[model samples]
Target: MATKGPEVVTDSKEIAEIYKEFSKFPSLSKASIGPEVISQYGGKYCNIYTEWSQRDLERAEWVKFCRQYIMFYDEDSIVYTGPSGNCTELQGELLTEESPSGIFKAVLRKHTNKKGEEKQFLEIWNKNSKEKSINLSGLDMHGKVYEDDQFGCLVWSHSETHILYIAEKKRPKTETFFQTKPQIDMTEEDEDSIKPEKQKPVKGDVFVYWEDWGEELVKKSTPVLCVLDIESNSISILEGIPDHISPGQAFWAPNDTGIIFVGWDHEPQRLGLQHCTNRKSGLYYVDLTGGNCEQLSSQAKAVWSPRLSPDKCRIVYFEGDVGGPHHRCSKLCMYDWYTKVTSTVVDIVNQPGEDGFTGIYSSALPQNCWAMDSQRVLIGTPQRSRKDLLVINITTRNVTSLTSGSDAGSWTLLSIHQDLMVVTWSSPNCPPSLKVGFLPAAGKEQRVTWVALNETKILPGINWKILTFTPPLEQKNPKFPAMNFEGILVTPSEREEGAPTPIIVWPHGGPHSVFTAEWMLYPVTLCRLGFAVLLINYRGSIGFGQNSVFSLPGNVGSQDVKDVQFAAEFVMKEEFINTSKVFIIGNSHGGFLASHLIGQYPEFYKACAMRNPVINIASELGATDIPDWCTVEAGFEYTTGQLPTPPLLEAMLSKSPISFASQVKSPVLLMLGEKDKRVPPAQGLEFYRALKARGVPVRLLWYPDNNHSLSKVDAEADGFMNITLWFIKYL
Candidate 1:
């Protein structure tokens, strides 16, 4: 650690100006690839929807317009000669799309009123008749529309008459006596004389170890599967789904007799689905007409992303350990409905190819993973340190990499039609953009064509280089076998000849999550502000392999901390880095690592910024939604729903950042979301008070309305500005 502190400069005006300049850069909000083909007026076309917003930190309106691209292709080639489509004001927020027959389209939209009430409805429209459309709102049947995740889909029946979706049933009404009590002979002056009767709060089910429920609408009510009849505008809740099962991502089974979905065995009063990966979940099939529900994954403890082949012969799903984190290695399995035999297509181990390149497929596969022929599946996997797009043949079980090159970066498969695949590609240097290409067939090489829906807004001549680094053997823990771990160094495109640039070490959240070479606004902003950013994908990060990710659970503080230190040392050796001005910033689990780094290496860093960090694991075990996180990460057996013992508490405290609070000498900033339930605001406050009592310079900024992701318009903008100013003053 540096012995001398830099001179402090508090210039609110300069900070405001820096924020104003960067707010002009456009950023991607959402992107969707439409169906492979849509028949309109006897013409076949493909549609792509993308939403973008100017980086406005002050204004809350993030999405304004939806840019649409209609692709017209000939038998020989696709035409890319002129402007293909136009932009329109987005109709509510497009939730899901279903174009079963290619002539008709069904879309779900989530609309919120000025009063803050939200409603989700389905719109069925004919491709040829723009004016003829049917609106089916769940409100008519006292059901509230809901979706499991951002990419959650709505499935249309084989005949395209009914849509299967997940929704919440209305809560029961309170008794009239609880609502109000009549007071006799009470005058205005006597209002204080009459005391209101106190009613004891209704106790709900207790959540032991689970993810934070946050403030999702579905959590407050009972979630159920609902089928909406487009012609009758009638909605029927699928019955016989056990009360403990919360079904989502429902798709119509072959022949339209039943629906297949991933269902979580939820304790309504105990748990909510936000950020939850450790729940007891499985793939299930529910008959629509007879209302019979069947568990399809009896052999696996947890399963997700179930896909039925178009031919309706086999089913594919991902299976993983329920005891481990949700992002652990997932095995691909196929179930034959006719033979009732379940076979593992791929095990949960990282398989090395002939070239010795080893990796694991992402645990959370895309909703549409099955190919048009149902013989291949597209998946995103972590290779080396970056995310790549790969396709796996179900029969041969051969995985082929469809993307390469240093800039290939991360690719998300949005929609695929027969031969054409629509995806979004992004990297540290390149902004995210939508692309179209033909799927690679066996023994054939295919090239994808990029489409420009919106112009990539360059930060006015700003350039950056993303370099990868691997730590030496000494950084590895002897307890675990040797594994590959890497970090990314992001340096500004232009530097004063030999001047050393200040650097910020960033560790991503989800100690189980990996930091890919994807386009992120925060690190890019820091680079543009003349700072080098190092993103360390320490031992516990996902995508490396099951062993690496599971390694951190039992050795959180020590192993992860060393990985970061090694990364810093490796970067410091570079002549262009200012070791004296090094700072640290992280969120959630990343924040946990940052806190540990500052404490363990008190003299090494100049300043530290933590966003919703886990300060005291002992206290967190009781209040956090994921209490199991504490037990599992502490190297203890998975024991949630049980009270913590003295020994367990001791183990958690030993690994907590609070254990090192007394040694922290660097000025720290705590960015907390008041509404955050994951690492409750209390955790930050505990550390803040401790640092203040120790006479250390510390500041805490709380966003009252924001949750874990402080990415809300105003909160995100303000956070960026505050961190920049904090680093400017201290480093």
Candidate 2:
């Protein structure tokens, strides 16, 4: 049986205290170290970075206080406090790009939510100008700019005369046909209405719906390849792009002869593009000399992030299979522009190397990822529980870990400029901060040391360590063998050995996504309140070899549930984990597991919390933006017109947490975003009603204005506070 639950309270002193303690950690939500700044002088280089600070988490407003910082990095220290520009994009995202010749830089501000005619701004910066103001705002354009990595590309031509980018195509004007004509009397100014026929009104375009890319890319419907001539102050939409395909990740061909981009096929259907790389997309090169467009990539279902080498001789990109598991280890291949030959630089790894290097779980490649030699590229990937940057020799196919094996933090390449690289490193206890490092002289990647750019937070009581957990070497599935997984344990250092303290098990969302070793607000907040947190990255998680990832399918509810339980039990035996006061919290798929933990093992947890969790797979199948996720996760391939059979649907229901809801006794706190398209709020309501009917303590928090992430300032802050209070009350 589960422990008794607490009554719903609007405010409490405990909530206030926890909120104040968690607020000390600054939120680096919109922070980034920018566009490749290669200006070096006397072993020192300059760069631009932006950070956003919220006014107050209590406010429901939708704006942020954004600040830009100019920093200089030298062999000794960094100058990070200089504020250079007052130009900030508070309402949208600011994207910057520097020209090859270093004479010009382009800045684009994408107004994300609004779809008005003028939704984006393109500005050019004259780097060599002597005037006080070197930023020149360019012509206003239609539709929001494509700032997303999957479809966004902003590059300047080699000729230094034009800029190429991708954005939502301009929507045609629509009006109701039943609308009345202008009531003004005819005059010389209105000769068109008097002497000629009135303009025809669109009959039904107002009610016609055009499907968007779904989820995070909701505003992005039809992408149009466009070019801007800064020298002539003219912008034109590029022709020759197929009408059935949506273009993105565009770049200029050598010498500005044409443009190369990835085109996603949207003819039959268009699925959500966010967090998914296995969509049906192909590489295409459009020739300006003859307006000819040709498919450059040979047979491939998905290809992404085609980055040209520094010499422009090779185009390197990531390729993956189509459908099913949204993300997996993809093949890294290089396209020789001159020879028109494609060769794999790195293939999928079934197992880890002797050095503990699993195959590349590439998130994405940086714009300037090439080293000075151009034969090498730096790829950032999840190395088990943490992120690691691997320096791969394109020619030799040899890989080296850029980060030391002992480091507990995650390292991501923010921007790479030739020999100098800008990286963001953070751990569970440390706040996210920028670090700069230089590429070592060939075979010396292990010797490279990073210089800290900004100030790092030092928490005296907070400490985190990575713990490896192994499963029994038995056959669950022969083709997909079992593998060892790891979990990150965060604890307060003040707690003595074998001391009694509450333990919280945090499983990451995305049955596919792993819990990275970065600073997370809620997990750390719980740890600060004297609770130990075990963030587990189970067997099927990325960075754990393709075989382990493949093992997840067909065994979703049983395999993943046991792995998390095994992780908790493994840690409890080794650490001073308080088993009696154990709790669980999760968002999305993590929520799915939390539900399973409490339902299947009712007496294990004192209380539980879930955010936008998938409760019933059968109910969510038709509503979720990724319907294919339903088919693939149930241990089957996703195919159009392949709805589940009755027995299959029953199997899916059995895999859902709702199937075991009647056995649940633990108090459940559900947080849902009403506007979420991924997992609708109804899923949470279903569980809420079931728990309520069973007389189990349950509360549902519904945020109307938020999305799947619950990223709004008030939603996140308040949600964390409520979760903390609930755990405290149960304890």
Candidate 3:
């Protein structure tokens, strides 16, 4: 690591100004600081965490805008899009039901071929018989489809065929919007009526997470709830209130009489409460019978999986602050209509404490962590150290220990189904496995089976084992503090008996996020291709507590790059890794850190890949719509410190990776999204031009329609495929 720079000011304001100037320069270059300067200045940790964590929005309630996985089932099979955009996979296959509950089943899958044309498919599955592939590619589906009460009837937002809010009903056997737009016939009123205004076609998934009542609205292109009418053999749109809201989690009152959904309010035309700034929303009652809506509540925060009881009288959800650390305690709250009480189900589990942020310094996450029955609710609270999972009962206010004495860094709840729970577990020394346990009628939960990922044929020839490492220590509070740096190593499934394998060091995005042993698909795919992958849990990553998380800001680019280098070195010294071909790649903030490595320690890596890197930090600060505390928390303002235009310009210029473009000799592949509002297009273009000017081997790939991160099926898949190919050819 580079030695500390010159002694600087200790006064808060003057030090802030110095930092402003300091950040402008390339990240603390060893060559840039002179001894004379070093003698004049010293450095200290800025206590940004306490202030930043205080700004942590409640972990619950529905925030106006957050993205989540939206999936639909066909037959008995469940399908979902890959988080990395490889392609939608058939998660679980469902057998054909002899006496089907519904007439026909439709599967929604996104398809992207070699040429990269994006399209959505609605595969119609036959319940009575088996068919090779239910191809609905030719069908023109403009909006969303919902199941109505009618047996064969379905509702849709088919903008192409039907006018806005015009619900089209069709027979179960009939293809609704698949063929043509819904055309309204001529009438006396039609003669004088004006055509509706033209707007862009609705694209992508139709869900936005909102509060339980479907009242909070975050505007997503995907629709959250699907309204079905099974008896009519036809369907129509369940159109969310305030038109244009993207629904996230939904809860329907028992009897399925009244539906409550969480979404953003994009339009203010509807008669319900309207939310702002894409925050979590609350309580909207849609009378399925009357086709009307009622505003139930108004709250904001990200609410996870709001569930209704069998009787549908009570709603339960996990709520947290948007700005809070992801590993902090999130509350399980229950809402009752009869009592008009919104009370905490369990005494705010995972409070602000050491074990709460589990993982090496708290990069572990506690989300989608709840289950419920008629009598009580169960919440999975990550215990201090993250080695065990606690099952807490909301009704009795009692806590039961589930898995104990496990390695703190190795165990996590994977999925909860009915009475069965699936977990992905590991330790520094044990490979991860899928462990299944059943809820017991008496005493503790029952341990049933432990299935290693190798037992499945999902991906052939891939063998994964657990890795353990101790986080490097700090002078103060050295005992595995939150956000410490430790690295995990992954080896290829098909490897020579004793030959060293290629290594690709990867830093997860979200300087706040960590690498979990959660059966990652991309890394496994890389392993399948005969490469060793190193996932480093760097400082500033979440799941660790406030102090470790605080270390990331102002210095994330510098410190995280060191962690990457350290991981690479660790691999080189280990028996399995090929020291000659070490490569590094990352997305988002990870992308920025990648570039930092090439400029800062160009010799450590053979080649590097960066996706949506933030090269021009100052430019991003000016362009972002971030809240105030976030800006201060990021050390942007403190670093820049009210400098005049020229000094500020110099400061920004010094930090821009473009400033060191000429020094970077390693080849680089740049991937950028055209519509990325978070890290604008120029961040990529500036670096590309600079590298090209220096005659460095660099290539730029642009996705015209994606924003921030590549989410579309084609773009996401192509990104991984191309990046892998790049690694194969260059690393």
Best by TM-score: 2
lDDT of 3 by residue, 150-170 (tens): 101122211111111111221
lDDT measured at residue 6 in model 2 versus the true structure, 0 to 100? 28
Compose the digit string of candidate 1's lDDT tens values, residues 481-542. 56757777777756665467788999888888777877787887677667889988887777
lDDT of 1 at 57: 49
Residue 469 in model 1: shift from native, Å?
Answer: 5.2
Which stretches of model 1 miss by more than 4 angstroms?
1-45, 51-58, 81-83, 110-120, 128-140, 148-152, 176-221, 267-272, 351-358, 361-363, 445-475
RMSD (CA, angstroms), candidate 1: 6.9
Provide the lowest-lDDT 10-residue window in model 1. Answer: 1-10
Backbone clash pairs for candidate 2 read: none
By TM-score, the better pick of 2 and 3 is 2
What are the per-residue Cα lDDT tens digits for candidate 2 across 1-731?
A: 43222222235676666665656555444334454454635444455454544435555544444555666655434444355667453554356676776667677765444546344567777856421221112233446678777788889998878888887776655678777766655566666544212434456698888888887787788998888877676777888998889999999998789999999988787888878888988889999978899988875579989998889899999988888788888899889999999999999888887878888777578777998799899988998888998899988888998995636789887666657777778889887776677788678788776776567875667788998877776624567654788899998777544456678998888887888888787777677667889999987888888888888877888888988888888887888678888999999999999999999899999999999999999899888888888878887778776766897798789899999999999999999998888888999999999999999999989998888999887888889888888887787
Q: 235 in model 2: Cα distance from truth in Å? A: 1.5
Off by over 4 Å in 2: 1-45, 48-93, 110-119, 127-141, 182-199, 473-477, 496-499
Model 1, residue 663: what's the lDDT?
94
